[model samples]
Structures are given as structure tokens and as C-alpha cells.
Target: MTDWAAFTGFTGLVLVVLLSFAYVSRGVPHGDGASVSFDDNPDRETSLDGSRNDVELDGDELVSAATTENVVDGVSSTPIVPTPDSAAVSSDLPTHLLIANVAVSQALLGAFLALGAWYAEIPSAALGISAGDVPTKLGVGLALGLGLYAANRVGSSLSRQFGFTPDEALRESLTPESRAGWVLLLFVALPLIAGFEELLFRGALVGAVAVGFDVSPWLMAAVSSAAFGAGHSAQGRLGIVVTGLLGFVLAAAFVLTQSLLVVVVAHYLVNALEFVGNELFGW
Candidate 1:
């Protein structure tokens, strides 16, 4: 018999490495760098009249000042503020690339896992990949997704009240400027993310470990959920904790219903609601 646990574990590792490379290559900075700040300099500042006097540096000290029209080295002395078109292009490029990379990678990974399951001779039903009651599953998923969203809102409020700053990376990713980008995120990337993660964690990892080790399903769920949380380490401590708890709930739902569709829908709804809330209400 093949060591299914090892196979699934290796697959998960590869996915993480690929995703991390994509993120880093796109210069998607995490933590403090995710947000734009304008508080570095207090002495060299703009005036209240929306204009600035350019200062000439002499041995690292300001020696003289001139108006915006003053020329320096045969070039215009005015500060070049980015045009709206230029700014949009610069911002949209990274966001588009990141979303595309995630969506494509996840779709491919989900397909690969399905093929692996077939090759391993695992029954589809055993892996919770079979179709069940569609309407009921969707309803349950929507309800659970809303519940999680509400809980997350409350948690965020409490965190703010306690002086904990929110995750800037998350906030940036959810707020897209272009309508096309937002549509792709909601319809393409979110589903791919949900499908791939659920298939990997709840389906492949849990199923393989349960069969290979002859362990209880719940134990496998817990172990796989932990791995799921670890995969989200880029989101920081609170993100990992909240994602872990959500993964646990998803695992339990899988165990109860034996339907991958249910969990995928639930996960997608959760992400969708998060983006919508963030965009509409600044949640």
C-alpha cells in the first residue's frame, strides 16, 4: 500500500512553496509595508495651502528655499504627482498578477488532487467528493458563512477596542480599484481558493491520513485543520487563529455531511462576504 499521508503532505508543501514564491515575486509586502504612510518627515513638510517650498540641501542641511516653479539642473523643480491613469496601472498590475497566480495555481492543484485520489483507488464518497443534496447544502453553507462573518466582525470590533491594529495586507487585497478586478476576485479567485483549500485539507490530507493510519476521522480532521492554519501564516497570529478555527468548523461539517461541495460553498461564501463587507462598509 502507498503511504498516502506522505503523498498528501508533499503535495501540500509544494503548493505552499509555489504560492509563497508567487507572492514574493509580485512584491506583495506583508505587515507594515502593506499600508502606505506619510509620517516619516516632520521638518520637511507641506504647507496648509497645498503647496511646498523646495529647499536646497547644503551638507545635509537646508540652506535655501525656492518656489515650485524654480528649476534645478535644467529640470522642472515641481514634484511629480502620479496621474490617475499611471497610479491605476501600477496598482492594478500587482493585484491582477497576484489574483491570477492564486486562481490558476489553486485550480490546477485541485485538479491534481482529484487525479491523485483516483490513482490511489480511493472511493469518491469516502473522500466526500460526491454530490449530495444541493439546495440543502447551499442553504446550510450560506447560513454558516453568514454566522462566521458576523463572528469575525465582532472579533474585529473587540480587537480595535483593545488597540489591536487590523491586517493591512488583507485590507489591501480585498479592496480592488477596478470593477474587472473585483469581479475576477469574487467569481474566479475566491472559488478557486475555496475549492483548492478544501480539497487539499479536508479531502486529500484528512482522507489519506485516516486511511493510512487507520485513525478516527475526527483526529484526522484536527490534524489537517492545524496544517490548514499553518498554510495561512502570512496573515499573522490572529489570522492563523481565526483561520484555524474556521478550518476546524469546515472539517466538522465535512465529517457530518460527507460532502466537499458543502464546505467549498461555505468557504467561498465566507470569503465573498468578507470582501463585500470590506468594500461596502469598510469592515
Candidate 2:
């Protein structure tokens, strides 16, 4: 039998973390305008009006594509102006520092969760860390991530139609200047975010909660997905709703696969693709 005391502790902890994140993120500027985008070139970033930022990059730093009008399919179009959060890294937090800070925060949070689970006598397998076929799981994860991203694109378009603009400020604010920053984002921060979020939101919130209460995982998913949305409230209302839907999908996947790795990989790809799509494809 599961320990209700330990379960309650986990529930409380999750609630506090989600609420805190939602609170802090509300301070970040939300973009009502369209999202910032760059081209396939590593050197290009975004800002429009064909002007360089006042703050100069050192040495071989990546140049931006935002400040100029670029021709796509024979039509000259300028990128959307970034919100205050990314208008200048100088006034706000620098991009690299922000990425590093997030990486550190995720690491610390993951450690805490791990320790708590151990103390609660929760096995790793119960948390969706079973010995499974790695290759097949990864392939499945990749496909799911790609598929979800496509759905996300459609959802975003529909949200815009409904006059609910999806905020892209957080993503814009994380735009990197140096190659090192990209490395940190792709290798460290993204993986940590994926692992920690899936572990907490799906593995614990949906899977473990159902097992402990002998309740339907779908009911747990509904409850947990709300918290997932709350945690992303910095992204604004449309984002919160969209993210909540995405969370439910992932939660369902976790219920079906019983593997955190699947969701982790899928989650990582969704984020990574968003960054890449904007930076490289201007999508």
C-alpha cells in the first residue's frame, strides 16, 4: 500500500512549485505581436527595421536576422518586433545567464524530487524508469514529438483566429548570442526540463496518483494538466490553455506507454523543434 503522508507531501510540493513558477513568470513580458524568428543561418537572429542593437557582440558572436527585412518566396517581409523581455538583453537579463540559471534551477529541482521519492520508498520503475528497449522507445518518442509539434502549430493558428494570441516572449528571451549558449540550451537545459517535467507531471501526477488512490489515470491527468498549464502561465492565457492540452496528450501517452523516457524525449523534441523552426526556418 502507498503512504498517504508521502503522497500528500508530494502533492503539496508540486502545488507550491507550480504556483511559484506561475507567479514569477507573470512578471515576464508577454508578446501580443507575432513571435520573433530567424533564418537557417547561425549568424542570423531577429529584430527588424534593418538596424543593429546598441549592445555589440564580442568577436564571433551570432549576427541577428530580426533587424532587417528578408525576402521569402519573392516577398519582402520583416520579422515582428520583440516584446520588452527581449527588446534588449542589456536592460533585462542576458540570454546566456537566463539559460544558465534555468539549467541550474532544473538540476536542483530534479535532485529534490529524486531525494523525496527515495525517502518515500518509491521505486524508480514506479516512476517510469523501467528497463525497456531504448532504441524503439526513442523512435516512438521522436515520432510523437514531431506529430505533437504539428498539432501545436495548428492549435496556435486556431487560437489566433479566436483572438487568443499565444505569447512567445519566453522563447524569444532565450534567444542565444553565442554557440556556447546553444549548447547549454540543447544539451543541458532542454533535457533537464523534459526529464523533470515528465517525471513530475506524468510519472508522478498521472501514473503514481492513480495507483495510490486506485483512481482513473484520466482523472489524475485532468487535475495534473491544470497544474502544468499554471506553471506556464508566464506564456499568457492562450499559452496556458494550449500547454494544458498538450500536457493532457503527454499524460495520456505516459498512461499508455508507462515510460517516462518516451515523454521526456517527446517533450524535448517539441521544445527543440520550436527553437529550431524559428531560428533556422523562420517558421
Candidate 3:
């Protein structure tokens, strides 16, 4: 009775447009430079006590001085210097705004999924949301998460060796510039991202397609994983491929455990670890 094909198509189209917009906006240069550069100008030098004595200006344009330490909250802070050509606009979104956006998006997704499940007459268990063996599901999910992370690392290393650059969009969005950014990433962004993605791709999309078409679960997994990868177009070609493969693994886990909790935990761990490694260790 459910028009699963139409539903899947519409969802895929919406995701594609949103991802494309995110990618294109990041690609557009915010100012007049492709990159930022810092240079030394003797006239703008700091004193021996790490204090600037002169405020340098060029044609009414304020020049950001070289790195200076500023104490904030009783800790030494690295002054964010503007680029030689253009001022550095803070890429970090306000914490409250970011959290509110994520919360609203997740709430909308939850509502959509609920409606879809009802329309399809699909049992909650079939969508991997019903209560199950919690301990076993968590264990399997954690193991899969670790394995996926290792695979991603190896793949990334290989890509770098082949002259692959990191995705600018992802870097801009995920890399935190302040303590507040880190808190939002860890506490808000990561969980909502993981939960909503797994629910949509693995739980809703795969389940509906499989039920509506009477196709094998593997086939539905393939379809949904492709959409998942497509949603990451900002990450470039190799990123899409790698993400697609990883999506399949998550889908497989969802199928095996028949528990959304397992896949959500695994997805959360993977994203959290990636952000932490990138932020703390520059990996």
C-alpha cells in the first residue's frame, strides 16, 4: 500500500539538493583570496613583554599583528590573526544557533519517520527501534565502530599518499575553533548527526524500500547506502566512495542486529572519534 519508490526518490532528491548547497557555499570564496597568509612587517613588531606598541594600518585597513598571547579565563590564548589580504571571518557558528538548527532538523526527521512507519504498517522491530538484547547489541555495535574507524584511517592514509586533499567543507564545519565549538560538536552535533542519519538511511529508507518492493534486504541496503554516499558530495569522489562503503557496513549491522540502538551507537562513536582525532592530534 505504501508508495515506497516515490518516497525514496523524493527523500533522495531533497538530500542531494541540501548537500549540494552545503558544498557549493563552502566552495565560494568568502572574500578576495583563495588562502590566507601571514607575513612579518618590522614596523608592526611586538615588545619584549609580548605586547604590541603600534597599531599598523594600510589605507584605512587594519592589519592584524602577528601571533600574540592573550590570557583568557586564566589561560594563554592564541590570538586569531587575520590573513595578510583578508580578515579571517570566524567560521564557527554560534553554539546556540548550531544546536537549535540540529535539534529542529532531528525533530522533523523523527516526525517524518514516525509517519512513514505508520503509513507502511511496518512494525517498530522491523525498523530496528524495538527493545532487544541491549548488551549484545551494544557490544556488536562498538566492535563494528572500531573496525570501521580503522578501515577509514587506512583508506585516508592511502588517499593522502595519492595526493588527495581533505574536504574543505567538512574541515570548515567539523573543526572547532574554541572550547564552545568543541562542546557543541561533542554534545550536540555528533549524536544528532549519527542518530538522524542512521534512522533515515538504514532504518526508514532501507525498511520501506525492502517492504514495498519485496526485495532482499541486501538490495535495499545497497540502494540506501548509495543515497547516504550521495549526501556527502561535499567530501569529493573518493570520500563518497569510502563513505558509501562504510554506509553499507552500517546497513549490514542494522540488518544483523535488527536494532537501531546498535547502529546509532556505532555511528556516534565513529563520528566522535574522527572529530576528536582531527581536533586534538591533527590526524
Best by lDDT: 2
Candidate 2 regions exceeding 4 Å error are: 1-4, 32-91, 157-165
Candidate 3, superposed: residue stretches over 4 Å from native: 1-103, 118-121
- State how far residue 58 of model 3 sits from its true place (Å): 25
True-vs-predicted CA distance for residue 243, candidate 3, Å? 1.0
Which pairs in model 1 have colliding backbones? Answer: none
Report the Cα lDDT for candidate 3: 0.57
- The backbone clash count of each candidate, in order, is 0, 9, 0
Ranking by TM-score: 2, 1, 3
Q: Pick the candidate with the highest TM-score.
A: 2
- Using all chains and alpha carbons, the TM-scores for the candidates as numbered come to 0.71, 0.76, 0.67
Give candidate 3's root-mean-square deviation (CA, Å): 10.8
Candidate lDDT (C-alpha), each? 0.60, 0.66, 0.57
lDDT ranking of the models: 2, 1, 3
